[model samples]
Target: MKKTINWKFTLILLTVGFMTAVQYNSMKNPKERDTRDIWAVRHELAVEKQLHSELLSEIRELDKTIFTYKSLNDENTGKALTETVDKLYSQAGMTNIQGTGIIIKVKPSAESEAFGIPVTDVSPDLLTRFVNEINRFKGLILEIDGKRFTTLSSIRDINGITTVNGLNVSTPPVSMKIISPSFKDSEKLYSYLAASTIHDDFYIDNLILEVGKPERFVEIHGSPEMFENQFLKELPKGE
Candidate 1:
């Protein structure tokens, strides 16, 4: 009777252990699957972005060709040719963009926890300071959190949160894309940020800077038309 009782207890223990392992495996498998799905989504998004950039470039080239033909014929409307080109480039976020640029990624500091410091959230002041620093180096075409910076775009602090171009920065590792016509132009921005990484600008805010190499292609996306804020002013009278 004692031997039978012991054998039954051992069997039950084995069964419970096996069930627990299966449950753990089941939970882990879904997490892995979710990770794969997330990666796939990111890959799709990048591909679509590249396609859109190509299409925009082609459209701009066609428009330039048409404008050039008008100018060669000395058309009156050609007088605004230069102005129109500038407007198109501004709208496309490609003004004076002769070459590629660097992408600076700012992430939450990893060692903050180890040092018993908590500064996980990115502050508006940090974003503004970063923008100012890059601009100081003549970094053209500044974009933060995928929102291209225009003359009207700004970083604002509201209710203890940071908003860039009126959008909340709810994620870690904010990306800043900067384009310059000269490699040296982008390089200056890159070098400044690289050197600043070791400075207190990042340490005080608990941030990590990752300045990527000069990419061959960098297309900063503009805001949608819905985001346009119309300023009220009297229009200039047409002659």
Candidate 2:
């Protein structure tokens, strides 16, 4: 009985050893071979991530390049943008269409103040001098008392109505529209006119002045070639 039990125990130990050896061999050289596959998959994924990052970076650079190209192509991009916005404003009926410039409406003071002063306070010579002064600053005169500079003067003898320089301009209080490049120039001209000796003895009461561009006028086309070199330098490569 003792020999039989020892042999049984020895067989059990040998079976356990053989099972352990099989498991070790299987781990060492697996049939499915998933060990190297896991490492390879991880490496591939890492490479793919790196490649994706690189592609994304390159795409960002491409977007910048496209922006630069567009900016270079449009020399008047800022003006174009402004026009677009203005057009939108017009479409919305929020834009006021009027001539832009300084409107100097100089009228004679009340008759109660001075008796000798004539109703037509602003003389033609004084008007001419004012116009000349405005011209010195490159200001373009648009209208004088509802009469454009291009039109001819009219006279009405029957009703004692007379017009000078195509405008039914009154002597004391004259209304004129002068367009200058800037409000500063307009204000300067206005100050000079107001302080001049020509208007010293006159009873000037109402003086209305405003500055802005006219909505409707003959469009003046500027030369693009005037800034050709600047445009060229601003142009994109190969454009």
Candidate 3:
């Protein structure tokens, strides 16, 4: 009888231990899944950004051809030419956007300063992920440190400096202006960004991301140099 009782107790202990392990694994698997998903999204966005840049370049070329032909020969050219130019400028991020929007600022974290850890350049990887996430959340006309974020805009690291649209944003207190479609949209984006783990990501890099309240007249400056297809001028007419 004693032997049987001891065997039953041992079996119960093994069962409980196995159940605990299974529960722990089940809880941990979702975190792994989330990490994989984030990375997969980042990879997809990188590929898509490249494809988008190529496609937009081609589209701009076609538009230039159409514009040249229509402007040179069309009888009712005023309206059509104006519309075409506007569309081209908008797509090229050359037209200033003024409307309701949100501002995001990145600066050195207080904790890092308190801990005597010197602030470092913002990680390109983290910035890319943050930008992609903002785009997904309906952020339009995004300007980072006064540089317009376009399809052709490149954000990368050069000698430990974070370059955005050929401008260095390696320093702290980098400001990002996001012009949304409307006040409601801007508010929604602000809220979404406020609750995002993006802040945590920046914190890991010794920075803090601040999402400001949505406000009116948030202007995003544009660049005339955004579309530099001047070679289109050399193309022969009617070809």
Candidate-wise lDDT, in order: 0.72, 0.52, 0.84
* Model 2: ten consecutive residues of lowest lDDT: 219-228
Order of models, best lDDT first: 3, 1, 2
Q: Estimate each model's TM-score.
A: 0.56, 0.34, 0.66
Better by lDDT, candidate 3 or 2: 3
* lDDT (tens digit, per residue) of candidate 1 on 1-239: 99999999999999999999999999877755444687899988987886797789879978987876666755655656676667766755644343579987877677876787755667777777777666554327877777767667878877777787677776666787888777777777677777774446766777777789887688777665443438966678883
Q: What ordering of candidates by TM-score runs from best to worst?
A: 3, 1, 2
User: What digit string (tens of lDDT, one per residue) describes model 2 on residues 177-208?
Assistant: 66545556556756766666545433342222
Candidates 2 and 3, the one with greater TM-score? 3
Clashes of each: 0, 10, 0
Give per-residue CA lDDT, model 3, range 184-221, as digits (tens).
Answer: 99888988998988888888898999899999989988
As a TM-score, model 1 comes out at: 0.56
**TM-score, structure 2 vs. true:** 0.34
> Top model by lDDT, which number?
3
- After aligning candidate 1 to the native by TM-score, how far in Å is the CA of 121 from where it should be? 2.2
lDDT, candidate 1, at 141? 81
Task: Show model 1 residue runs off by greater than 4 Å.
Answer: 1-74, 78-98, 113-119, 197-199, 226-239
